[model samples]
Target: MELFEHLSLGFGVAFTPINLLYCLVGCILGTLIGVLPGIGPVATIAMLLPATYALPPVSALIMLAGIYYGAQYGGSTTAILVNLPGESSSVVTCIDGYQMARKGRAGPALAAAGLGSFFAGCVGTLILAAFAPPLTELAFKFGPAEYFALMTLGLIGAVVLASGSLLKAIAMIVMGLLLGLVGTDVNSGVARFSFDIPELTDGIGFVVIAMGVFGYGEIISNLAQPEHEREVFTAGVSGLFPTKQDFKDMTPAVLRGTFLGSALGILPGGGALLAAFAAYALEKKMKMKPGEVRFGQGNIRGVAAPESANNAGSQTSFIPLLTLGIPPNAVMALMVGAMTIHNIQPGPQVMTSNPELFWGLIASMWIGNAMLVILNLPLIGIWIKLLTVPYRYLFPAIVLFCAIGVYSTNNNTWDVWMVGLFGIIGYSFVKLGCEPAPLLLGFILGPMMEENLRRALLLSRGDWSVFVTRPLSAGLLAAAVLMIIIVMLPAVKNKREEAFVEE
Candidate 1:
C-alpha cells in the first residue's frame, strides 16, 4: 500500500511535460548511438552531462537513466545485424544474434532479445521495489571496516570474473587504483601524484576518463580494422515476432536471467557484465539437445538469455547506488556525480529526505522501459537500415560527436586531447584481447575502496583483522576466493578453451 502511494506520487512527477520530453529525447538518442558500433551510452551520456546542468534533478536523472537502458536495447540491434556489439554487455548477444541474422532469422532473434529484455527489466524493477528497502536497511549497518571488506570482495570478484589472463586483470586494477589516487589526499590535505598540474588537483574528471577510455578508445580500435574486414548487414529482414518455439525457449531463459542478473547486479563491480557472462554459462550448462540451435551460432536462447541478464543487471545496479551510496560500475559512479551536482547525498536517507527524486526515478524506469519497447519494435526496419551506411562515413560522424561531447564537459581542450590518447589505449586493449569493462569497474571503485580502507584502518588502529572480524564481510571474501579458485581450476580452463575454439 505504501509502495502504491509512493509510486503514484512518482508518476505525477515523471509525467510532467518537461520530464516526458527529456525521456523521449534520451531514448531516441540512446537508440541511435546504440545502433552505431563502438559508440556507447557512456560516451553519449558523458557528452550530455553538461547539458543537464539546467534541468531539474528528476528530469535530468530520468533522461540519463533512460539513455542507459535504452542503449542496452539498442546495443542488441547491432549485435544481431552486424556482428558488432555496441557495448560490452552485448558481446554475448553477438555470438548467436549475428549468426541468426546470417541465417535470415534476424527478426526473430531481435524479437527475442527485445522481448526478453523487456520481461527481465520489468522483473528486475519489481525486485528492486521489493528488495531495495531491506538492502537499504542492511547498508545502514555497514561500518568503515565492513565497507572496506566489501569493496575488497568486489575488486577480487571483478578480477576473477574478467576475461583473459588473471595477471592482466590485476595489473589493470592496480593501474586504475593508482590513477584514482592521483588527486589530493583527503585525510592529510597533501597533494599526491598530480604532477603539479592545476587540473590534477581536482583529480582527473570522470567525464574525461570515461570519454577517453570508452568512447574514443573504441573508435580508434574500430578504425584500425581494415576497411574490407568491416562487415555490413544487407539482408532483408521480414518477421518482427518470435515463433512459438522461440517464446517457449526464451521464457525460461528470461526468468533464469532475471534471477541471476538481479542477484549479481548488487555485487560491487562489473555486476551487469558478469551477469550476462554468467547467464550464458548457465544456459550452456543446462545442455539443450544437440539439434537445438548451437550456443554460439545465433541461437535465440543465446540472444534472449544475455539480453535479459544485462538489462536485469543494469536495473538492479541501482540497488547499490541508491541504497548504499556505492556505485557498482562507472556509469553508476557517474550517476553519483549527477546526484552530487544536484546537492543530493546518496544514501539510505535519500528515500526519506528526497522521496520525489527517489521514488520518481524508480517510477520513471518503468515508464522508460515501456517507452523503449514501443520505440524499438516498429523501428526495427530503421535500425536495420542503419547497417547499410558505409563504415567510413558513419565512423567519422561518430568521432565528431565524441570530440564535441568530451569538449563540452568541462570546456577544456586538454580533456579532449586525453580522450584521443585514451582512444589509442582503448584500441590497444581491443587488439590485446583485454576486457575494458572490468578496467572501468576497477577505476570507478578504486577511490571508494581506498577511502573506506583508510577509514577502517584509522578506526581499527591499523589492525588488518577488521575485515575478517565482520561476519558478512568475511563471507563475501570467502566467496570471492572460492570463485577465483573455481575459475582457475584445470577443468574450468579446459572447458573455457573448448568454448573459445568453438567460437
Candidate 2:
C-alpha cells in the first residue's frame, strides 16, 4: 500500500507537462544518435550535459535517462539493418541481427528487439523500484574498506567479462588507470602528472576522452576499413511485427535476459555491456532451436536476449549511483556530477530527503519507455533510410559534432584538441584488437578505488589485512581471484579466443 502511494506520487511528478516534454525530446535525440553508426549515448549525453544546467533537476534527469535507453532502442535499428552497432551494448545484436537482415527477416528481428526491450525495460524498472530502497539502506552500512573491495571486484569482473584477450584487457585497464591519474592528487595539494597545464589540474574532461575514443575513434576505424567490407542496408523491411514463432522464442529469452541483466546491473563496472554479452552467451549455451536458423544465423533469440539484457542492465545501473553515491560506469559518474551540480548528495539520505527525485525518476522511466516504443516503431522506415547516407558525408558531420561537444563542455579548445589525440589513440586500440570499454570502466573507477583504499588504510592504521579481514570484502576478493583463475585456464582461454574469432 505504501508502495502504491509512492508510485502514485511518482506518476504525478512524471505526468507534469514539462517533464513529459523533456522525456519526448530526449527520446527523439537519443534515437537520432543511435541510428548513426559510431556515435554513442555517452558522447551524445556528454554533449548535452551543459544544456541540462537550465533544467529543473527532475526534468533534466528524466530527459537524460530517456536518452540513455532510447539510444539502446535506436542502436538495434542500425545493428539489424546495416550490421553496425552504435553502442557497445548493441554489438552482440549485430551478429544475428545482420544475418537476419541478409535472410530478409530484418523486420521480424527489429520488431523482436523493440518489443523485447519494452517488456524487459518495464520489468527491470519494476525491479529497480522494488529493490532500490532496501539497497539504499544496505549502502548505509558500507565503509571505505567495503567500497575499495567492491571496486576491486568490479574491475576484475569488467576485465574478465570483456570480449578480448585477458592480457590486452589488463593492459587497457592499467592504461586507463594511468590516464585517470594524470590530474592533481586529490588527497595531497600537489600535482601528479599535469605537465604544468592549467586544464590538467582540473583533470581531463570525461567528455573529451569519451568523444575522442568512442566517437571520433570509431569514425577513424570505420574509415580505415575497405569500402567493400562495409555492410549496407539493402533489405526491404516489410513487416512491423514479429511472427508467432518469433514471439514464442523471444519470450523466454527476454525473461532470462531480464533476470540476468537486473542481477548483473547492480554490480559495478560494465554492467550494461556485460549483461548484453552475457545474455547472448547464455542463449547460445541454451541452444534453443529456431526454424531452420542457427544461434548466430538470423536467430530471433539472439536479438531479443541481448536487447532485453542491455536495457535492463542500463536501468538497474542506477542502483549503485542512487543508493550509494558510487558510480559503476562513466555514464553513472556523469549522473553523479549532475546530482552534485543540483546540490544533491547522492547517498542513502537521498531516498529519504529527495523522494521526489527518486520515485520521480523511476516513474519517468516507464513513461520514457512507452514514448520510445511509440516513437521508434513507426519510425523504423526512417531509421532504415539513414543507412543510405554515405559514410563520407556522415563521418565529417560526426567529427564536427564531437569537436563542438567537447569544446562546449568547459568552453576550452584544449579539451577539443585532447579529444583529437584520444581519437588517434582509440584508433590505435582498434588496430591492436584492444577493447576500449574496459579502459573506460577502469578510468571511471580508478579515482574512487584510490580514495577508498587510502581511507580504508587510514581507518585500519596502515593494516594491510583490512581488505581480507572484513568478511564481505574478503568474499568478493576471493570470487574475483577465482574468476581470474578460471579465465586464465587453458581450455577457457581457447574458448574465449574462439568466441572472439567468431565475432
Candidate 3:
C-alpha cells in the first residue's frame, strides 16, 4: 500500500510538462547518437554533463536515465542493419543480427529487438522500484567500516570482471587512485599532490576527466581506424512486423534474458555488456527445436535474448548507486558525478530527504521505455540515414564539441589543457591494451573510500582491528577476498578470458 502511494507521487512528478518534454528529448537524442556507430552513451552523457547544470535535478536525471536505456534499443538497430555495433553492449547482437539482415529478415530482427527490449526494460524498472527501498533500509545499518569494505568489494569486482590482462587492469586502477589523490587534502587542510599549482586547491573537475578520457579520447581512437573498415547494409527494410512463428520462438528467450539480466545487473561491475554476452551464451547452450534457426545463422532468438538482456541490465544497474551510493560500472560512475553536481549525496538518505527526486527518477524510467519503443520502430528510417554520414565529417565535429563542452564547464583554459592531457593519457591506456573502465571506477570511488577509512580509524581511536570486529564489515571484506580468489583460479581465469572474446 505504501509502495502504491509512493508510486502515485512519482507519476505525478514525472507527468509534469517540463519533465515529460525532457524525457522525450532524452529518448530522441539517445536513439540518434546510438544509431551512429562508435559513439556511445558514456561519451554522450559525459559531453552533456555541463548542459545539465541549469536543469532541475529530477528532470536532468530523468533525461540521462532515458539516454542510458534508450541506447540499448538504438544499439540493436545498427547491430542488425550494419556489421558495426553502436554500443559495446550490442557487440553480441552483430553476430546473429547482421546475419538476419543479410537474409532479408532485417525487419523481423529489429522488431524482435524492439519488443524484447521493451519487455525487459519494464521488468527491470519494476525490480528496481520493488528492491530499492529494502536496499536502502539495509544501507542505513552500515557504519563507516562497512562502507569502506563495500567499496573494496566494488573495486575488486571491477578488476575481476574487466576484460584483458588482470595485471593491466590493476595498474590502471592504481593510476586512477593516484590521480584521485591530487589537490588539497580535506583532513589536514594541506595540498598533497597539487605540485604547488593554484588551480590544484580545488580537486580536478569530474566533468573534465570524464569528457577528456571518454569523449575526446574515443574520438581520437575512432579517427585512428582506417576508413575502409566500415560497411553499412544497403538493403531496404520491409515487412516491419514479425510473423506468428517468430513470436513463439523469441518469447521464451526474452523471458530468460530478462531474468538473467536483472539478477546480474545488481552486482558491482556487472552491467548491460556482460548481461548481453551471458544471455547470448545461455541461448546458444539451449537445445534448439526442429525447424528453428541455428545459433548464428539468422537466429531471431539470438537477437531477442541479447537485446532483452542488455536493456534489463542497463535499467537495474542503478540499484547499488541509488541505494548504497556505490557506482557499479563506469556509466554509473558518471551518474555519481551527476548527482554530486546537483549537491545530492547519493545514499539511503536520498529516499527520506528527497522523495520526489528519488521516486520521480524511478517513474521516469517506465515512461522512457515506452518512449524508446515508439521512437525506435517508426524512426528506423532516420537512424539508417544517419549511418551514411562519413567519419571524416563526424570526427572533427565531435572533437570540437568535446573541446567546447570541456571549456564551458569551468570557463578556464587550464581545464581545457587538462582534458587534452587526459585524452592523450586515455589514448595511451588503449594503445597499451588497458581497459579504461576500471580506471574510471577507481577514480570515482577513491575519495569516498579514503573518507570512510579515515572516519572509521578516527572512531576506533586508531585501532586497526575495528573493520574485522564489525560483523557486516568483516563479511564484506571476506566476500571481496573470496572474489579475488575465485577470479585467480586457473579454470575460472581461462573461462573469463574466453567469455570476453566477442566471437
Candidate 4:
C-alpha cells in the first residue's frame, strides 16, 4: 500500500509536462547515441552534463537515466541490421543478431530485441523499486570502517570478475588510484602528486578523462582501422513482428535473462556488458530442442536473451548508486558527477530528504521505457539509414564534439590538452589489452575509500585491528578474500575465460 502511494507521487512528478518532454528528448537522443558506433552513453552524458545546469535536478536526472537505458534499446538495432554493435553490451547481440539478419530474418530479430527489452526493463524497474528502500535502510548502519571494507570488496570484485588477464585489471586499478591522488588532500591542504601545475591542484576534471578515454580514444582507434573494415552490411527490414513459434522459444530465455541480469546488475563491476555476455553463454549451454534453430544461426532466443539481459542490467545497475552511493560501473561514475553538479548527494538520505527526486526518477524510467518502445519501432527505417553515413564523415565531427565538450567543462585549454593526453593513454590501454572501465571505477572510488580509511583509523585511535574488529566490516573483508580465492581456483579461472571469449 505504501509502495503504491509512493509510486503515485512519482507518477505525479513524472507526468508533469516539462519532465515528460525532457524524458522524450533523452530517449530519442539516447537511441541516436546507441545507433552510432563508438559514441557511447558515457561520453554523450558527460558532454551534456553542462547543458543540464539550468534544469531542475529531477528533470536532469530523469533525462540522463533515460539515455543510459535507451541506449540498451537502440544498440541492438545496429547489431541486428549491420553486424556493428553500437554499445559494448550489444556485442553478444551481434553474434546471433547479425547472423539472423544475414539469413533474412532481421525484422523478427529486431522485434524480439525491442519487445524483450521492454518486458525486462519493466521487471528490472519493479525490482529496483522494491529493493532500494530496504537497501537504503540497511546502508544507514554502515560506519566508516564498514564503508571502507565495502569499497575494498567492490574494487576486488571488479578485478576478479573483469574479463581479461587478472594482472592487467589489477594494473589498471592501481594506475587509477595513483591518478586520483593528484588533487589536494582533504585532511591536509598540501598537494600530494601535483607537479606544480596550478590546474593539477584542483585535480584532473572527470569530464576530461571521460571524454578523452571513451570519446576521443574510441575515435582515434576507429580511425586507425582501414576504412573498408569500418563499413557496415545492413540487411533489409521486412517482417516487423516475430512469429508465434519465435515468441514461444524466446519467452523463457527472456525470463531467465531478466532474473539473471537483475541479480548481477546489483553487484559491483557487473553491468549490462557482463549480463549480456553471461546470458548468451547461459543460453548456449542449454540443450537444444530437435527442431529449434541453432544458437548462432538466426536463433530468435539468441536475439532476445542478451537484449533483455542488457536492458534489465542497465536499469537495475542504478540500485547501488541510489541506495549506497557506490557506482557500479563507469557510466554510473559519470552519473555521480551529474548528481554532484546538482548538489544532490546520492545515498540513503536521498529517499528521506528528497522523496520526489527518488521516486520520480524511478517512475520516469517506466515512462521512458514506454517512450523507447514507441519511438524505436517506427523509426527503424531512419536508424538504418543512419548506418549508411560513412565513418570518414563521422570521425571529424565526433572529434570536434569531444573537443568542444572538454573545453566547455572549465573553459580551459589545459583541460582540452589533458583530454588529448588521456586519449593517447586510453588508446594505449586498448593496444595493451587493458579494460579502461575498471580504471574509471577505481578512480571514482579511490578518494572515497581513502577518506573512509582515514576516518576509521582516526576513530580507532590508529589501531590497525579496527578493520577486523568490527563484525560487519570483518564479514565484508572475508567475502572479498573468499572471492579472490574462488577466482584463483583453476577450474573457475578456465570457466571465466571461456565465458568472456568472443564468439
Model 4, 404-426: lDDT tens digits are 77777778999989989999998
Give candidate 4's whole-model lDDT: 0.86
lDDT of 1 by residue, 1-503 (tens): 87789889888988988888888888888888878877766766766676677789989899999888878888889888878888877888888888998888888988888888988889888888877777878888888877776777777877765666677778777877877888899898888888888777877777777777777778777777787876776756887798888888888998898899989887766777778888888898886965788788767888888899989999998998898787777678778877877788877888878888888888888888889989998889888888778778987776777778667767888887877877788777778877676666666677888888898888889998988888977876787788778878999877645443324
RMSD in Å for all candidates: 2.5, 2.3, 1.4, 1.3
Stronger candidate by lDDT (2 vs 3): 3
The 10-residue segment with the lowest total lDDT in model 3: 227-236
Query: What is candidate 2's lDDT per residue for 92-185, written digit by digit as tens?
Result: 9999998988888888898889888898889888988888888887877788988887778878877776776788889988988888888888
- Lowest-sum lDDT 10-residue window in model 2: 287-296
Scored against the true structure, residue 467 in model 1 reaches a CA lDDT of 82
In model 4, state the lDDT of residue 267: 84
lDDT at position 381, candidate 3: 69
TM-score of each: 0.92, 0.93, 0.97, 0.98
Runs in model 1 with CA error above 4 Å?
285-292, 461-465, 470-502
- For each candidate, the alpha-carbon lDDT, in order, equals 0.81, 0.83, 0.87, 0.86
Order of models, best TM-score first: 4, 3, 2, 1
Q: Candidate 3 regions off by >4 Å? A: none
What is the model-wide C-alpha lDDT for candidate 2?
Answer: 0.83
Q: What is the lDDT of residue 194 in candidate 1?
A: 89
